[model samples]
Target: MKEQTLPIIDTDVHHSPDKKEVLAHMPKALAARGLALPGGNGFGNPHGVNRRDATPPGGGEACSDPAYTLEHHFVPNQIRYGILHPAGLLAAGVSADYRYAAALCSAYNDYMLESWLSFDPRYVGAILVAPNWPEAAAREIRRLGGRPEFREIIMTSASESPLGREQYWPIYEAACEMGLPVAVHPGAEGNGISNRPYAGMPSSYFEWHTSLSQNYMGQIASLAIEGVFNQFPELKFVAIEGGIAWLPHLLWRLDKNWKALRELTPWLTEPPSELIRRHVRLTTQPIEEPEKPEHLLQIFDMIHAEETLMFSSDYPHWDGDDPRFVLPRKLDEAARKRIFYDNAAELYGLPPQESTVSEEAANSATPTN
Candidate 1:
């Protein structure tokens, strides 16, 4: 956010653990059953899962090693803090055996703690819990949620039922009690436990990928209509890997619908959009780049970008946006600082050293032509 490089707090960097790595931590019985990452239940992903370029030079997959990730992302990019999202293995959200699901999630969290969080001061984790088993998930959250290394609780965005349903309340309760935000990421689609993209399964990966925002839209609406914000006033939710452009449209539709249907959800005493503004935040990745760059700024303004949006590189993934170039080059300083650093800093409870930016430097920087 400064004329000089500002420290970035990336909210949606992904870490894809190999099956063997995770299974090595699980019980033999569980390991024998076998597991694959979240991109598919069994069906092959028609499209590749990550960028070839993102694979570490040392080679495994993108995000396989803390050392490789540091060399590739944090050290070179001037990132002060990164929230590690391990969404790939969260297919546990679809596991039939709640015990197995719980075990897998717990083991994965342990692996993340030892392998990533403990290994690096700059990196923090989102405790992945299987929402399919709310009680066990809550236990998992309570178990690991208090650790300084884990700043949030994460679950698959595409779940068997809309996340706002009463059954998921336990998980939300645990996050709120621990004072950690809930980050729902879009992946693991069509995996029995999670819904496929809207209007039944799409025929192609492209269609499936493009419709991810619809899933977030449904989740946001469900949470708002069901009074989740009212029920858990302290809860904060972040929609990860979902681009920010759709937010204004969603809020607009929600407000109009709520005015007409307020009687349907009396508990949502205020407008649905208002609740979303107060309680929800979104990550910027897979950003919806427009033909005209200036139009991007208008969308941000419409969505109150400073208050609601945060930047995420979605690192090691093909679509990862470079911090230097991802945002509009001529963005005003205040908007740039909040999107790149401050919003995520406050949301994730980052220390002042990582969260604070030099606003004077940003303000004084020469404007781009």
Candidate 2:
């Protein structure tokens, strides 16, 4: 199949609500405080965040206009589904004032539902929740999780504590009850009131961006070693925009440590790698490109890419991937199909497209399990 002909489900397309619009959804008192969503730490991108061509013709933010995004991004790319992650609220989880953070997240969800989701059938959203206030976050999940357009719950990776602590169990429970996957997206690390990067602060954006994967490693290890999967078997955790290459090493180290320390985590009946394979999913953007293309393929195989990986454009961002050229051309067609569409479709409960029926049938006949 030609690259253009393949069905695509972009799992990390970003869209931001107009600040005035989001404020309107908030309680008047909270809105009056004039608190905006927390921006990232001081390291500035030398190049701007959005692609030069992404700005809407009407002169607004890159993805702030749904109609413009559909025409310029989804339709042109033939994306069957575009999972909207709010760019502005990516750091909301790290806000110092927990009540304001929760209120801001709730407001963002309302803005997405009314402004973006209703505007297009292809647009689905991740429910933004404040990590600091898990009970309030759970309430937000319960409030909007039933909406067909909201498929997952999202929070920033930057947090005062790792995500697997019991405080976050309330949010996970609500997501499980609503059958929504919980996702962590980067942008908040070393930002606002959240904890600084594990290696202290980086001196440049280049250093910081390269080190983003460290945050994912810590969170994934915490979630696995802390037995989050054991408590919530139905839960799926997505690490979005975090590169995939480090996963093999992380999983290997986790399994190695667990072997010696299994008694400490009795709830983890199986290896950490096994639990991660079952409960965690990752997106492909800023995918690591090794000098030898085959080396990247080896990493994919090591991590069981067919089951755990999904495609994401990170649309409108400066470093977003293009569906036509992101993965190596030499990758197997069946695996490409799974990465581009099948895996995400299954995770988000989207129906199979006629274009992919043949691949789906072949895959089902030889199930990965």
Candidate number of the best lDDT: 2
lDDT tens readout by residue for model 1, 1-369: 533276688898887766676778889998888774445534434556676766777778767777667666775676777898874676778766777888888888888776777666677788988888999999988998889989999888878889899999999899899999998887777875577668888777677778888888889989988889999999999999888888888889989988898888889788888889989998889889999999998988888888999989888776788888888877888888888888988888886543343443222222111
TM-score of each: 0.91, 0.94
Residue 12 CA displacement from its true place in model 1, Å: 1.4
Each model's RMSD to truth, in Å?
A: 5.5, 5.5
Off-target runs (Cα >4 Å) in candidate 2 are 1-3, 355-369
How much RMSD separates candidate 2 from the native structure? Answer: 5.5
Model 1 regions lying over 4 Å from their true place:
1-4, 36-47, 353-369
lDDT, candidate 2, at 286: 81
Residue pairs with backbone overlap in model 2: none
lDDT of 2 by residue, 1-369 (tens): 344667789999988678888878889999998756667556688888998788988898888887778777876677877898887777778888889888888888888877787776677888999898899999999998998989888888888888888988999999999999999998888877777886899888899889999999999999998889999999999999999999999989999998999999999888899999999999999899899999998988998899899999999999999888888878899999899888998999887766433443222222122
